[model samples]
Target: MISEFTRTAVPQLVGHELEFSKSQHEEKFHSLHEAESVIREELEELEEQAEVCRKLFEDLHSDTRQDDKDGAVINAKYLAGSAEYAAYEAIQLAAMCLKLVEMAGREDEV
Candidate 1:
């Protein structure tokens, strides 16, 4: 089941992505190929952020001293931010896929 936060947040993030895309680009994607390229780029960024979070998680677990652990806890907040950005990227990727379908006149099929 979807949580209330997800229900509220996903649409808001997607809307933001749509607005940002419009501001950044004068034209919609020219073709599926172009849309695919953009989607791949977003996916790459999401993957990179995931890697960052993984490294942070490993560091958080590996540290021994109370001071070091305290620092790791603070760094975990950075991990949370990275995860949020990754979610945004995922939403942006979804929005782009929807746009591609609409551009192809296949929204009805979806």
Candidate 2:
């Protein structure tokens, strides 16, 4: 089941990604090939962030000391931050996909 936070947050993040991309790039995707390259790059970034989250989760599970509540809390917060970043990357990837769909639709109308 999807969490309420995710349902709302993902679309908002996708919109933010689109705005950021528009600001950073002078042109939108010119072709499906170009869009594929951009999507691939975003996927690589998402994979890297997911790996960071995975390592952090493993560390939190294995290294957290039962007596050191403060340290555990810190580790948990760090994990959450990394996970959030991964989610952000995912949103960017989704935005890229949406862009591809939009481009395809436009081509169809031509």
Which structure among the candidates has the greatest lDDT? 2
True lDDT of residue 81, candidate 1: 89
Global fold similarity of model 2 (TM-score): 0.82
Error of 2 at 35 (Å): 0.7
Please state the error at residue 49 of candidate 2 in Å: 0.5
What are the root-mean-square deviations of the candidates from the true structure over C-alphas? Answer: 3.4, 2.2
The CA root-mean-square deviation of candidate 1, after full C-alpha superposition on the true structure, stands at 3.4
Candidate 1 per-residue lDDT over residues 20-72, each given as its tens digit: 78678734687778989988998888888889889877777666345587778
Q: lDDT for every model?
A: 0.77, 0.83
Number of the top-ranking candidate, with TM-score as the measure: 2
Residue pair clashes in candidate 1: none
Compared with the true structure, what per-residue lDDT tens digits does model 2 show for residues 1-110? 99999789879889888878867873368877999999999999999998888887777766564556676677789989998888888989998888887778878899
